[model samples]
Target: MAKIHSHFDHVGSYLRPQALKEAREAFAQGKISKEELLDIQDRLVKELVHHQVENGLEVISDGEFGRSWWHLDFLWELTGFEAYQQEASYKFHGAKTRTTNVRLNGQVAENPNHPFYRDFEYLLSITPAGVTPKVTIPSPSLVIKRDHRSDLYADYYESWTDFLDGLAKAYHDTIQRFYDLGARYVQLDDTTWAYLIQQLETYQDQPEQRRIYEEIAEDDVYVINKALEGLPEDLTVATHICRGNFKSTYLFEGSYQTVAKYLGQLNYDIFFLEYDDERSGDFAPIVDIWNGRDQVELVLGVITSKDPALEDIDAVIDRIQEAAKLIPLKNIGISTQCGFASTEEGNILTEEDEWKKLRLIKTITDQVWG
Candidate 1:
């Protein structure tokens, strides 16, 4: 629907490593206060904003540097939620459940000074006079999934319907606020749908959980579309769905087939689907779903972020052609499977390697879309 524009997911690396390392080491040794650390975080934020714009990137994020974790800290920072730490067993690929204490929500508060609000304000203030920068927030669907604690919520919220209703309302309000502050592109980073796909084979074993996940997928679409409902039509919205890209370990593995219903019916203007490897299965399902929809756009993730080796240009082009066979070539574009750093702990690649990967993406985009 638009010209061949290029954007990336999770581009900002870390909180300016040099400043962070110095500040962290000093703070750990009792040389700096929390305020001082946050001050350094602010400086790093500016540097990151500049770096993202300078890297030939049109869409920019805070690189998620200010917070400790990507999803929870920001969700915790928002008003209307009291977050506390709890350890749980979450599986990733072949590994056993690792004990990680992530933030869980209890209540919602109202405030004019939310961290995400301030994060967007600060970025807007520092952005060069004319450049429009995009702000990313974890998908409300994923946030609800992350905050799902059966023990705490089953008693208070009483039923799944009430809980999801509130969850959807919170997100709708949050996006409204962001839109008021000049956010043109709001990318919802989510993996819940992928998680559902990954556990498909075992669905029969947990019939109730399967039902819950199915509802979650539909709720995910409903919440996003609800949030987008009265907003300016030009405020381009897109979604980046992934199979948990943490430490290169995955939580889901399958093709676009598992989630084709939602993918085909999603109300967003654009969909960024993962097709970097066999772990993502085939593109045939998406091609079938996308049939006859000229308005929806697809970003084909042809470059793999899992390894350091660069992809052969010809092979990359061939993959694009394969995907184009399913979805119209005009509706498809290209990008990496995931970001260089989906979390605070960056991926295994060196910073230089990350740029190389991006350069290749740019090169291929120029050749294919031009």
Candidate 2:
């Protein structure tokens, strides 16, 4: 088996082409057939894969083109989850997102016929040899974190641990399915960790709030570890920590200090952390947790994806070197802080800018790592 490296990685999601978005909307409104919608997705994904290869990236993804929302799309495909438009939208910083909410409708179980299976198959069919095909899905913690009304499902689960166990089993089966389909590198795009950091500010003054935050932090690690159990040794698990990306506006803000100790508890091989700005805080805490671990790698997101402005190469290199002072240089990699498009809306940047950002990552990565 080829050893998977996190060098010059992307967070998986890419900006959706306008035509593809329109086609999806049409399909939702009953104007286009599912086949027609998929055809559009297939074409665009082919182009996206080509772009990734042309950019000199070793790992390629389907650009998550087959779905609308990143987490909701996958969750809704499960046995007992249902997606519905909520009455209110998620209010981000100076931006609003579409009100798509997923609810627990039945018992959660893995659906063997999940559409992402076919999406990955299409991506693998088009990818060239030597380039690894990667698949990104919402971490199991997101499912538990977003279950805002679990109380309503009291009849379904007897306790919180029971609910988490079911979700973990479903994720384990789903991951095994992806692995069987030849996905050696699987990434879990998680924002729940960042949300926990945001809670630090909200509960700093109250002892009870602080206690609850600590409990959730522990639970977050438990859920992720459970989901990762019993996987093949050759399969590489990566996780991308997100601080929210929609229309270029962020949803949460904080440093890793709040969660630094818990970081080592996650069983992922690589961690694609967001450090594009001050909102991500400094890298000292990362150095503290990852100091002696040779099996783990860190892909520091030194480039910003929220805007069109490009970062200076020298400055980015300086930051990377600074991080190396703590973590070993060999275990470090480079990538964007988050995906260019966490949702269908994407960030406030042009397609050209997005490509340039990726190119910039490759450039910086070579200069630093070489």
Candidate 3:
């Protein structure tokens, strides 16, 4: 809703050093109370919001302050699910696999309260005098990726139509409730579709797995479209798709060509695509759907958030100009390739370094869009 743009990342760094150190130590010793943890989070979040506003960012997020991982924990809050840490491994760059018993799943046990709404409610108290805050949540489609849920079986919803419809309703209800509370922008952090597109090889290696991957991609679009069925025409809803961002490295790397057809049909107001490096591929495929009738805007990730190196503002402007050849400049904007903190593990950059990246993005954007 604001004219200036900002990147989303971790809120942990925004905490007062003493408070953060205390929280970490207390959690480690299992000596902290939930209320104490939340209280510190609240103070940190308020400061985070003020910091963003001061730094010249247009839209503000809670910096995903309270959650551990961006997608999973929120997916757990959706409905009929429980989450727990479990042993699992993910392939990192250089073909290295990291194994950790991180948070995995249980079931869609009950429809507990949505964290997006509760967090926003807490954030409302800290919003700056005039700035409108933006809320970001993992896409509802992420539920498909959560550690094997029993209810999501072969005949889970009686029919594919029923399953999709339910998903749409749940997301729509959740987002609408937030909109009703004065949120002008709601962003769906959809890494599921992006990952499916990039990991085709991983799925293709096993015939049995390919079908599940295809179904999830198709169903993600269906569910997202369904959720957007009816809502405020003026409320801006955006989607940020990334291959994966963990500890300054990536998991999947590819372009939109794999899912371009479905991606072109999404119903969001804007699409924040990761185009920071060669791994994202050329922008030609994106140009194909850039002028579609659905009224989608493109928030180009021209600045690399993963590395500490600052982009030459002149070169960044040239790329934006280059992208305009395919899509109108009016429909384009710039941001970091992904959030400063896609996960708690965070990018390898220091807090000072991370903010420097944001500053560069803001400076370049002012030059190009001003």
TM-score of each: 0.86, 0.97, 0.86
Would you list the rank order by TM-score, best first? 2, 1, 3
Q: Name the weakest run of 10 consecutive residues (lDDT summed) in model 1.
A: 7-16
TM-score of predicted model 1? 0.86
Model 2 misplaced stretches (Cα beyond 4 Å)? 147-149, 289-291
Model 3 earns a TM-score of: 0.86
- Where is the poorest 10-residue window by lDDT in model 2? 145-154
User: lDDT (0-100) at residue 261 of candidate 1?
Assistant: 78
Question: What is the lDDT, from 0 to 100, of the residue 331 in candidate 2?
Answer: 86
Per-model RMSD to reference = 3.2, 1.4, 3.9
lDDT of each residue in 1-370, candidate 2, tens digit only: 6459857888888999999989998998999999999999999999999999999899989888887788889988988788888888876899988888888887789999999999999999999998999999998878665546344356688888888788888899999999999889999998888888888767888989788878878887898899898999999999998888888888888988888789878888999999999999999888755747888889998898998999999999999889988888888888899888888988888889999999998888888776
Candidate 3 stretches with Cα past 4 Å from truth are: 1-18, 21-25, 94-112, 145-151, 154-156, 201-213
